[model samples]
Target: MKSSDISVEAKGVSKNYSSVKALDDLSLSVQKGEMFGLIGPDGAGKSTLFRILTTLILPDSGVATIEGFDIKRDYKSIRRIIGYMPGRFSLYGDLTVDENLSFFASVFNVKVADNYPLIENIFKDIAPFGSRRASRLSGGMKQKLALSCALIHKPSVLFLDEPTTGVDPVSRREFWQMLERLKTYGITIVVSTSYMDEALLCDRVALIKEGRVLSSDSPRGVIDSYQNTLLAIWGDDMHSLLKELRSYNEVKSVYSFGQEHHIAIDKKLYNHNYIDSLTQKLEERGERNFHIKVIAPTIEDCYMEFSANKEGYE
Candidate 1:
């Protein structure tokens, strides 16, 4: 991508805290006006990378830029053009919704009314409780209010760190919809989320683990890159089934999905004869009541695969 088209860039960025390595030479780029997702679990360095890019903290080594501004040198300029909503609620709990919003607006030397149009869609949801203290708001309402404050300055780039971690399912869906709307206004959104399902919502995603990016691509691209043949199997005796499958020589990997267990096998080893042999073996072992079928890989499946083979990825 051209320099002008990139909204965020990081190269070999690393951070260490005492004996812990928070980020290990991590690097990625976000395109302007695109929704980019950093998909990972806790302690995967998502938060650390966000802090480095937002200029809240400096990296131990490597370089990063936001809208072509050096993170270390042009931090003041970068701060003015980017909006950040931390993983935790940083707003004063004693402040009312309106007060919180107004305070943030004032900090940026702008009036809430001046950028009302930019956040009207999001603010309208919490406007009803404008006079209510932030501490009294629901998890969903608090997030909406936080998002409103982040956008009050009409920033060019927005960084959200696990914004829906504790939100209800309905609220999570609504928050994603709000993000979609923001894209239309030519704002670059870089959000970090641990929800595997949410990874599919981004235009592109970087599957990260242990301070490293195992894979980065569009959701479909990542799934398409999965080389293993996946099979979804389930039965009454899940524990026994899992143990049995793991003992099988052909099974490459197995994970407990929501209601079913997903197992990976070499594509070359997948065949009708193999299935028949496996079925017979299970039946002979007193596991007659079971079901198995080939299934398409989901983002979670891909993530597990990538995480298992992190050394193979750059």
Candidate 2:
């Protein structure tokens, strides 16, 4: 896409701390007004990338720009035009909710009333707690307050680093709903999360691992690219079933998925008769009452497949 259409762009960015590589040859782009996600596990370079894009830290090499402004040269400009909510609640513990909001607004040289329109929906839920110390707020309430502070400046692009990490299920859902509402206001959002389930909520996602980007695509695109013949198997003894499945030469990979085990098998070995053969083999191993069936792949499954493939290449 044209540079004007891009809200953020990272070109061959790399960072290292002594011997540990935090990011390596990483690159991705976020379109204007799009909700993009950096989906990966902890230490997968999501936070490092966020820090680079937000101009909190500079990359050892390569370049990144936010809103057409260079992250290094125009960091001051970038800070003014973008809102950032770090993974942790860094607001002052001694400050009340309203005081914290006012502090952030003052830093941005704007009154809370100036951008109240941007944060009104989120602040309303916490308005009654305006007098409560930030440290005394519940996890969900703290999250809402942090988001309100981030939006108090009406930034064009918001950077949220693992916004839902410590939140409850209900609050996580509510937080995503707030994001949906924010999108209508034409703000570009780049959120990083280790939760695989949240990938579906983004317009597009970049799957990162071990300081590199494995894949970047729409959620459906990633799932559709998983070519493995996955099988969901359940049995009397899940532990033994997992062991037996792994022992089979036909099984490429196997892992527990809730109560059942998901195994990836070679396409050549996946057939109608393969189930019967698998059952017979398991029966000889003293595994009985096991059921096996083909299953569709999920974003998690695709993530595993991509991660495994990347490992093989390395």
Candidate 3:
């Protein structure tokens, strides 16, 4: 992509905390007006990378830019053009909803009234509780309030680190809906999430693990890259079935996915005879009421596959 089309860019970025390498030669870019996701679990260096991009901390090596401004040399300018909502609730607990909003607005040398339209949809939900202290607001309400504060300055880029984490299922759904609406305003949203399912909501996602990127592609692209034949198998005794599947020489990998175990096998080895052989083995092991069927891979399945072969990506 053209440099002008890029909103955020990182090249060989690395960070270390004494002996711990938080980020190891990481590199990725975010396009302007695109909602990009960093999909990884905790300790995967998501927060570390956010801190570096937002100017909260510096990286040990490599270079990065925000809207063409070098993060190291143009931190002040970068700060003026971006909004960051950290994973934790950092607003003042003693302040009321309206008070918190006004405080953040004033910090950016702008009035809440001036940008009221930008945050109206989110603020409207918490308006009735304007008098309530931030600490007293429910999890979902607090999330909305934080998002409103972040957008008060009309930032061109917004960095949300695990915004839906710890919130209810319904609230998570609502938060994603709000993000969808924000894209129309032409804001580049860089969000990090551990939820594999949430990766589908982004324009593209980078699957990270142990301070390395395993894959970076559109959600469908990542799933389509999976090479092994996948199968969803379950039986009356899930624990025993899992063991039996793992013991099979032809099984490449097996992991418990919700109520069933998802198994991957070599494409050449996956056939009708293989399925029949599996059935006979399970039946001989006293397993009854068992079922096996071919299944499409999900984002989580792709993640597991990449993680298993992370050395290739790193």
Candidate 4:
């Protein structure tokens, strides 16, 4: 297939360590110029997949390719075509932001001058502080600098692993905005994130757990896979509401979701009549300040159920 047809393709890949299976017959693919996301919490095999695709490690079995370059055999050309930013802040902290960017640019036989236009927008924000050590920059600035370096070589494919994990909310939002800009350049971008809300930002997402992909589709498609008529119940007494919700025989599953509680009920046993009865029961139990209503499933809800039966994390 052409690069335009498939930016990435993996078939029945597996990797193991002693008795632990880091990846279990996993397979995934991404189209050229598409911003694909891997959504899952830590230990979900995102890093493993990144390493395999980047040619940092060999898969014990199966095949993987980037723009049709076999990961193992065409690694040199593959490295030239892909820019990978790891989950950790791997940039040299003691080096100035400008220095770090220059170094990476040189590594790929490119210069800061060559790809200046590509990173011009993002670099302007931190260029004023260019002389500052990378260690001193705020999380968001460091993130931008790292991204600038990643693009300095103008790689066709980019892999970012949890790029916003430890950043503040504002920084996280800013980082995503940068990604949106990168997408406009028509480059294939694969990013892994632990935040459920971030899943909405992707053109499509793959929810992975314990080394296997549970579902791969557009964000809306994945969320719509949710089967239950979900409900979010909130109240002044959250603890009591949570306790009462899980104790109810009609409730199939209840998990705390930010400010509200997400619950899946057995429709056969619970309807308007059941909710009314449960509300009355709770009020009688001194949990009187709560409301429950039908709601659509969020990405988090779909991931929870989809990965519920997957193998436990290592």
Candidate 5:
């Protein structure tokens, strides 16, 4: 798609829920046919942003436009042009797979036969089990059915809010594959997810936290902005060692990364004093056999740094 063809645009959007600020002057633009991702952890205002963009809720100030239509003023047009799959499984549990799809299609005033070509590849997988109730479907199957229903109306833009959560890794991978294929149909996709790994799958991503946008760019662009050298350290008594490690003057930051701890130090300004001090400190505490070394930063690392930098503003 051309860069000028913006499918989603928001300008200085802000929202509040009584005493809590859900979004703060957040602005973003996404081009048509591009797979854009909104990444953040829980309670980071991701859901609020999705709600506003999908026209489920309105912002307190500023404006959001989808396909050149204002979310509040042109909500009916936007709703007709966009397909939304919510964060939770919202299909009627009492209805069968076919019934659920038929219902959603009817709500959108579209016939399943009209969009069969658009969803056949995915719907075929669930066709044999069409009679089964939605409540009895597995996570992967439920996800596929929901996706099919979302596309039944042939929406120009699709909004998926954490659609892969709770599904197994294999199912998550499959879900992403489906997204890639959708791009070929010229549909813009804006997906909000807490999964760091999923962030890399998008052509471009916006990292959001506490209702504010921290960074926006391609996955590689965001990762490239990470300025710190990260290192993973592991040893026994790690639980107790964490406190002593933080007490070091040379350590800039510390975060848990999978099985090990990602330790940050000012290699430019600080000497091995940080490492030596940590080793010595651990030894004094009877903690032994420690291993520490630098490792390449991941998308998750960039997100941590991005969110940490935002904390200063709060």
Candidate 6:
């Protein structure tokens, strides 16, 4: 990609909070109008990176740029060009929905009427409760209102930190739909989430853990990196199945995955007859009503693989 097409850039950015390092030489780029996701568990430096890029906090080392402007010297200009919605609801609880929107617009030196078109699709659902105080709104409604206020200024890039963390399932789905709509307006979006499944929704995602990036690629790309033979096994008694699978000397790892357990075996021990041999062994042990089948790897599976690899290296 050309330099002109980049909306956000970070080069070896790092942050230290006293004895703890929040970010460790992190570097990445977001192209114009792209929906980039930062995926990781809590305390994985997602929030720290977001805070740094949004100019709410400064990094301890390295450098970053927003719209090609230096983060330190050009922060004033960067602030005007980006919209930020923190993980928590930071709006005025005492103020009504209408008041919050109007206040943010005024702060940006713009009128709500001027940017109504940009936010109408998201704000319309909560418009009927315009008189309601922000504190009284539901989790989903508050999210929409916050998003509306963020867009009121017509920012070129938006930063959202765990926007769907506490929302309901339906609301989470709806929130992503709203993001999809926003992408069509030529706005670059950078969002962070702990939900591994949400990674599939982004154009690209960077898996982070303990202040380091484990991997960065499209969802499919990450899964494809799992160059291992995996199988899903389940039985009438999941506990027994898990225990029996773990006893196998060839099994590398076994973890519960919804209705079944995803079992990874050392590639050297795997063969076309491996499944048959496992079934026969289970049958010999009087394990009835069990099934084993090869399966595709998921984002969570890939994450676990990376985590395990890191641990082994250490």
Candidate 2 global TM-score: 0.96
Q: Candidate 3 — worst ten consecutive residues by lDDT sum?
A: 305-314
lDDT of 6 by residue, 73-113 (tens): 99999999999999989999999999999999999999999
Candidate 5 residue lDDT tens string, 1-314: 55369889999999999999999999999998889999987787888888999899989999889988999999999889999999999899999999999999999998999999999988999999999999999999999999999999999999999999899999899889889989999999999888888999999999888888888999999878878767788987677667777876666778887678887666585455555666677789788887877687888888887777767741
Q: Give Cα distance to truth, residue 231, candidate 1, Å.
A: 0.6
Ranking by lDDT: 1, 3, 2, 6, 5, 4
Per-residue CA lDDT of model 3 for 28-78, tens digit only, reads 999999999998767999999999999999999999999999999999999
TM-scores, each model vs. reference: 0.96, 0.96, 0.96, 0.95, 0.92, 0.95
Residue 213 in candidate 2 has what lDDT?
88
Pick the winner on TM-score between candidates 1 and 5.
1
In candidate 5, what residue range of length 10 has the lowest lDDT sum?
269-278
lDDT of each: 0.92, 0.91, 0.92, 0.87, 0.87, 0.91
> Backbone clashes in each candidate structure, one number apiece?
0, 0, 0, 0, 0, 0
Q: Where does candidate 2 clash, by residue pair?
A: none
Estimate candidate 4's alpha-carbon lDDT, on a 0 to 1 scale: 0.87
Kindly give the stretch of ten consecutive residues in candidate 6 with the minimal lDDT sum. 305-314
TM-score of 5: 0.92
TM-score of 6: 0.95
Q: Model 5: runs farther than 4 Å from truth?
A: 1-3, 270-285, 312-314
Off by over 4 Å in 6: 284-286
Residue 229 lDDT, candidate 1, scale 0-100 = 91
Q: Which 10 residues in a row give candidate 4 its minimum summed lDDT?
A: 305-314
RMSD after Cα superposition, model 5: 2.3
- Please identify model 3 stretches exceeding 4 Å from their true place: 311-314
For model 4, what is the alpha-carbon lDDT of residue 305? 72
